[model samples]
Target: MRPLRILLLLLLAFASMPLAASPAADTLAADSEARWVPFQLTTGNQIRFRALMDGRWVDAMLDTGLSDTAVSASFARAAGMKPLVQAHADAIGGAIPLAWTGLGRVEIGGLVRTGGRIAIITADPRATGPDAVDLFVGGDLLAGHALDIDYAARRFRLLPSGRMPFRGVTMPLRLAGSNNLYLTELAIGVRVQRGVIVDTGDGAMLTLTRSTWRNSGAQAGPVTSAVAYGAGGRVETDLVLLPDLRLGTLPPQTAELRIEGDTGFTARKGAAGRIGGGLLRRHRVLLDPRAGRMILAVNDAAWQPSRSTSGLMTAQDGRRLKVLHVMRGSPAAATGWTAGAEICAVDGAAIPSAYATSAVAGWSVGTPGRVVQLDLCDGNRRSLTLARFY
Candidate 1:
């Protein structure tokens, strides 16, 4: 009887004491520990952030498509990092030689990765700018980390592994070869496509293999031809729109997606395609590769379709604007504009030489039905009525 009485008294006393933290409280505490780091969206819509690499300040890009972290060859030489190994990697264009070296530390948003291998990437001579990317933070360092990107805020946060902040539809993430994260069960129209990669490095909304695009019963033509620059070299691609696309178990609102094409990368491992920043920017995304899961909360449900007015893909060559590709069925294609044709003036104004090194938008972009006149270096003049081709 005394033991029973003592037990009863103890239970009463414990019940009177304060209770421990609930699961909800624990989640809040964990979320509070996450620190937000601001990021900039480049003209190409790629995420760029300032990072400290081996105690040196550097501009870095978050690239999930890359198998390993990389530094520019120029940056490696300037930092005195000697290559320990030479290898080759397959890119969208082709296979390219790679040099691997040891990096002491890479810190971004106070998250540090130490003693990791980094590949050295050669810069393209055609891409000239003082603000070239110095480092690429790749999948090798992102594994086992919880990353939340709020595109509307232009900020991202790092939480403890297995901890996620945003709550929405959670999907399984497959960490495939080279630490690439692939999401499956993506429904484009009525057909379900599997093995879709999440590529933050790519600025396009989505990219499909040539075979995948044809198999989807999608209409041909009205595609804007352009040149995509990457690790190996430049590859010709066609940009189109994908309608009624839905991700795995996500919201039912069908998204109008801008899709590109690449023959090399998407065909590997039976991948259907890859989705990039153009689609991700509409949602608050949380990627937890360690737990093999991704969380997504749609921030914008309304679809904003891009209307290409100029239909001319041009690059600055020396002091002139060089035509890279003219979209078939576009105003430029209907004209005598050909690839390699250089432009001397636009709308009767001579282009300044500084435009060759500037980050300004090309003169080809403008409102629909806008009349644009161009003077070519070949002493030919042409007029184009800018309109939406697709």
Candidate 2:
């Protein structure tokens, strides 16, 4: 949370109100209770949960990085919400305007908060359809409760304040500003960095600030480039494999580390990086702001880096499959394939057009050591054998 960019409209009397009338007070009055709610992992690797917003059922994401709860602008318009105040949020790439409105109530798995001010923002284009996420529940709304996410079971639970949901290793969660968000320490090969933000909204395993990554002493390895979309806009990113990452007393694990270029959101005061859902999915995570700790219980003992065998990441573009990234040292990269190259077909099968309802680009990650032929839009054909790049 930062200073306001502009004031579009205001209701002076209501402007002084808090988000939820002190969630801690409500938590203290209630006994220990837990309610399990199912969630879905979107294609982008985000946590999507079913929630009730103003009595209407909608999809929501549990995003600890956000300071306040928000609804998609389309959802706000459809629900006939009136904006009370206007502000701006500094996001991944830059600042984004926000319109504050009040939702009568927002509930997820029986954990309800009322009379809260919600920000109206735009949703990603890929997040559409009847089951798309229209709401994002942030730290401000869940400050009083504990969040228990069981990634293996694809479920989440909300516990009353002071309730330690699991008996597991814990790490200190430090408050970041007045946003109710937190940062925790992360050890990368014995070099401890204490400014890692616990961000469930992000899909990447770990993202480091350019300066932080440069000084991390990471071992040399194959590097890949990719694009990410967020609040400000699209941003180019570089990815690498990091070895020996330890969280609290957990065993060392290998994970993919993303390096944010200049203009990325990883730059925060005294912040080293952000840990997102990609790595958290391998463990049962408990976030207790009131307790000032985050607990982790390993569900998948064999945690490994998520890498492409073919070293290629493609996206649907018009009537062709656009090569968005090619991992250095990968089979695809060895062919000198760069970004913006279009493939008209894969293994002789025509690539799906942008308007096609089905995805037929499965050949992008075919069996390892198996040869897949790509027909380029330039009327040239190339073949490569799938193999682990990093």
Candidate 3:
């Protein structure tokens, strides 16, 4: 009788405790403590943060697509980092010689990565906006941790490594590659199992190299030729609607993706294609690199419907603005602007590199009756009748 009373009293005591007082709950509560620094989520969720380099604040961009930290040569010199070794980097334009250097210290919102390695690209990367940055914070710096990226709220925070919060879908992240970029199994196609980089900087829905697309056995349907522009200048691609595209067990997403027929750059094992911010913007993403897991709180439904198109993507060349990717059935495509087609002039007047971005939208969208003249590097001149919708 006494033992029964004691058991009853213990049950009562357990029931009277707070809801989240269990051992597992306590561990979760304890692990949730992490330092989260606020960052300005600019266009396309480009992570822009100020970092202390050589006692000076420098603008930095966190690009998950790269494995090693690649800093601008000018930035390296400015930071007083000397050349450590001779190196070469490959871009859309091809391989170029560069110098490898290291910073004394890279302080990110008070978090420090000592002796950060950097590759000095002689000139600015292709995708530099008006506010060009000095650094590319790659996975080398972000490895072995959980990063929670909230696109809608523009929140970017870091969680404890190897510890996952019990919220959102968790997937596997594989780092078996020689590089530091995290890889995961996505349901794109069979032949293309590994080469997908989970990148937030990429604005496209899905981008696959020619080999990846061929391996996937995805039949080429009625398609439009496009030029995909990135840090590497331009890639000629085919833009088509992948009706049977799926990401793991998630509902098959019909995406108008770009297929790079001629990817000038050599991608590593997990580098053929990418799952970009175009798809990731639909949810609150949590990336646990340490555990190789991903948690997604979906804010958008799947297989909804059609959206608008820009049909035009451009990149900056030395002193010229060139057509990097022209969506098939886009305003630029109709004008026969292939990859490497330089925009020597806009409306018959030469435009500088600094004003190149604004020049495209201002002259094309909603004008209805403007002609953007082009002077191609291939020595063929063409004129594009401009209209809205890319």
Candidate 4:
């Protein structure tokens, strides 16, 4: 099926009410400016705006990543927007049951008009926490409009367009386990995946699910080093090299990607992965939450990596890890390591920077027969090892 048709069918299946007859186009043209305002949600999150429901205006987040507009059950009950029926929604996290309700009228940026039956689910119950917003406007609303997100200006723009800009190819996206939009084929071998939660709060290249990598024909290499946080907090993964990655219409190229075995894929299934600042920092990204589209303008001013180097590497979260940070059950985890233990020496030599040189350079996942002696120091004295863990 064509991408647009697929999106429409998905929307109609999820909408709770029958499609309402829209007002005449001329009637709407006159009131456009009076009803719409530039909307904003969390930066780099979703597009949101204020809309009138039952004579009251409320804040709503526009998420094309989702199939339908959902309201929190509590908020719906309070607003008397009860579900007319119940429908099942499949998300990356899991299958969610939701009630359906009709929204009288949806006015966007004072110009467009959309009236439909929307799904009403308990927002608090389905979300990780209560702060997870009250309303979600999904792909149903996006089908009729051209949407744009201006990050620098911090505003969202909507234009009435039958077709979206950047007609890239669409791929099936799966998060957690449910099938969604995986990537959009912009050029040959270049596809941009949606529903990727952007967490500027996090500082790393996009994280890939172990299954995502395994299925993508990418190989997991060695874990030469690891980073540790406080109190049993450590993430151990092998450094993986993706042969090529195509983001949107950008050219295909190889990049250093991390393999996360412990990623909470089952918990957050609605997202395929995350698109971080590392990629966006080099491009002007236009996000249309209402339209379910994004445009990436590569920045020539941004520094491009040389053919030999595969972009700059930064820690996933905030903390950095050393060789000792690799935990048990991991390639580095079984290295008989403990946190807070100091390294005294390596290979029967009392060398300075023993911790830095030995731990970072010596250990990896597939290294074979690489034996090295390590003098470990606690608060007391020292202990030595002859064989190294790969």
Candidate 5:
């Protein structure tokens, strides 16, 4: 599951608009035909599509960052596959015991494949994805096909696999050591060469190593100290509006970026950071992992990416909403909304309860510059009028 999407949505929350369901996996009239599958971008700007896992239709995220298409342990059990404990897998946060199994068949819009690998874990730690989602289609399978993602139109398509001309910057995709995932080197700030993991699964614009954030001396505007949540868990970060971000020889552009505190993640030999949906959403990206190449064409800039309306970044621990970070100049910051404080309620709606959390999250994503009230864990109450930070 994409964590940046969940955290950003928690800060900005999509207006909770209803979306039409993706087409179910019925037999296509023309099996060899190219099909455009419309995906719904959640309030957090995360992508999801209707997919078929073993002939059962389920909602799944289009996650290129993930090396292999994986299913939750529960889903694997439901599919009647015996999960063979393969040992453990380590991530940015820590290590988790992992299991593996095979799927009978997996189906995308018009594409179908049989006997696929699926990773199984005890639980889905990710906070994103629709409740109906059970699968995360990864890059290993996608690299062999012609996949087109049009963020401007908020849609993606699958074309027949072949040698097709592309109009964009092309880069060689190098696999992360001993893994099927691919990454490229990105020159950020000055003198800092960081590895960019092409991950559409992540929602944040960009998150850099804290050392990189400091060593580069990059100037950011209106800093917000907050905790960001994702599949692995929450981490401390200063959400900043980067004055500029450089990607190789590409033209520099001002972008929103996250500066994360180092948490002792076992970094790949020379790697330093990750690139998620935040940056990827700005382009029409095509990946060919097998051939070790990916193409990117700058999409229309008319689309507005998700930003914090309330200027608050929060995390849900158990039944409570912790105020992990607050954006500078936001009403919460001005009112001294400190990090590590629990939020009792938002807009007069109590949190710490499932329904209440949803209510507050929905309220947060509703609309920008709207007035809302807050009740903190310290027994203090304050009113906040929403405003966009980026």
Candidate 6:
């Protein structure tokens, strides 16, 4: 990862801390073992250990995209929680009613008691795929601690101060719009200025909101391309070029960004975008889902060579393709290909629309016999042969 990306990650982790402690008083200390407790979510997704709520420890999702801490209504009820009030939440699925419940006391590892509220919503624990987990803890819970998450080891550490020793650069969290926080020092043009959710599930580097782009000083190009998925899904966006954007304190560089118009029903009011595989693949990121904090470690050697080709490459449904962003001068753009072209197969293998660009990075770039065939919806099904970027 570059210095700017590292700064953005640090800022994200720092943003998770609560602005202030809840008025309710409760004291709970960290566990003696201090072992990272992984929590399973209803989505069958599991994240590193965060803090424990009450005697029944709660695992958190550590999502930056969320503005507050959230809990499943059924999980809260099952945990014997009675909320103080009902709050309405607009999720990716739709608007759902939730109950705001307070945990008497919550602890993590060896951390002390911190009083806080949890939003309870209805969720299907079984609905999460085989690898999905059930619970999610947003940024509201991580106000006071310095967090460290190590995915390679599946371990996490939480420190009480912001000055803890770490290998990455730390940056400030800049409030974008109403409830969004942007990591300042990242590459230019990349406007991940929304509250970010460190989601490994998502494939893109930055998921931008159409509103954010309109409000931003960044230059907006044309809606040169479109990406469609299996759920009758299609995203229409323009290629954005940010000249002097900042993530934190790190110097900014020119960056290629995507400006998505509407994410169907997935777009919400509070969050502007998401930081997913596109960013994570560039660094070693650790997330304390419970605490809602994260740490990003840049592997300069790993991605230094690929930095030049970052936005030039496209991945479709996990398959790397030479698809172009019709508007931008992408590799596919030079071939007279436009965006919204359906990438049917790579090397004759059928590719899914959900393919992540990072997954395709494993293949050597510019390797011959690496053909990318696509099926377009422009009335004429077209197939194009493309090369990988080294």
For each candidate, the alpha-carbon lDDT, in order, equals: 0.64, 0.68, 0.56, 0.41, 0.60, 0.43
**Model 5 scores what on Cα lDDT?**
0.60
lDDT digits (tens) for residues 1-390 of candidate 1: 000000000000000112122221112123434567789965455788888877889988787777677788888889998877776666655565667776677777747776646677664523212257888777667755777889889988777778867688887776675545445446665467767778777656666777777677654345665555555556666666655667666765433343435446567545777777667777888888778888888897663434456667776666677777676778888876678888888787777766633333344656778788888998988888987776
In order of appearance, the predictions have TM-scores of 0.82, 0.84, 0.70, 0.50, 0.75, 0.53
Off by more than 4 A, model 2? 1-34, 123-131, 303-306, 317-320, 351-362, 377-380
**Candidate 1 ranges with C-alpha deviation above 4 Å:** 1-32, 123-130, 181-185, 217-221, 249-263, 301-306, 352-363
On residues 1-390, what C-alpha lDDT tens digit does candidate 3 reach at each position? 000000000000000112211121101223334545566654443667776665777787766665566677777667676775775655433444567655456655425666535566653344544467787776766665577777666656555676555467666776535466566656665543664667665556677777777778775456766543456444466667777776655666677576665433425332666666667767777777677677777777462212323344555566666654566676666656565566666555565645534543344333455555666555557766655442
Worst 10 residues of 3 by lDDT: 4-13
Model 6 off-target regions past 4 Å? 1-59, 77-84, 91-94, 112-116, 123-132, 150-154, 174-203, 209-256, 262-297, 300-390
Better of 2 and 5 by lDDT: 2
> Root-mean-square deviation of each candidate, in angstroms?
15.8, 7.0, 15.6, 12.3, 8.2, 9.0
Evaluated against the true structure, the overall lDDT of model 6 is 0.43
Greater-TM-score candidate between 1 and 2: 2
Q: Looking at model 2, which ten-residue stretch has the lowest summed lDDT?
A: 4-13
Whose lDDT is higher: candidate 2's or candidate 6's?
A: 2
**Which candidate wins on lDDT?**
2
Which candidate ranks first by TM-score, i.e. highest?
2
lDDT of 5 by residue, 81-187 (tens): 78754745444444445576655677787677665455665433543633544777776566566667877777776655543445787766666654545576565
Q: Residues 112-146, candidate 4, lDDT per residue (tens digit)?
A: 33455667663222122113456666545543454
- The 10 consecutive residues of candidate 4 with the worst lDDT sum are 1-10
Q: Ten residues in a row with the worst lDDT in model 5?
A: 9-18
Residue 178 of model 6, lDDT score: 32
In model 2, residue pairs whose N, Cα or C atoms come closer than 3 Å (at least 3 residues apart or on different chains), thus clashing, are none
Q: Candidate 3 vs candidate 6: which has greater TM-score?
A: 3
Write model 6 residue lDDT over 192-295, tens digit each, in one string: 35453344433335556677666555654333333322111233455444445454443453334555555532244345555544445455454433233345
Give me the runs in candidate 3 sitting further than 4 Å from their true place.
1-34, 189-192, 217-221, 262-272, 300-390
Task: Count clashes in each candidate, considering only residues at least 3 apart in sequence or on different chains.
Answer: 0, 0, 5, 22, 5, 49
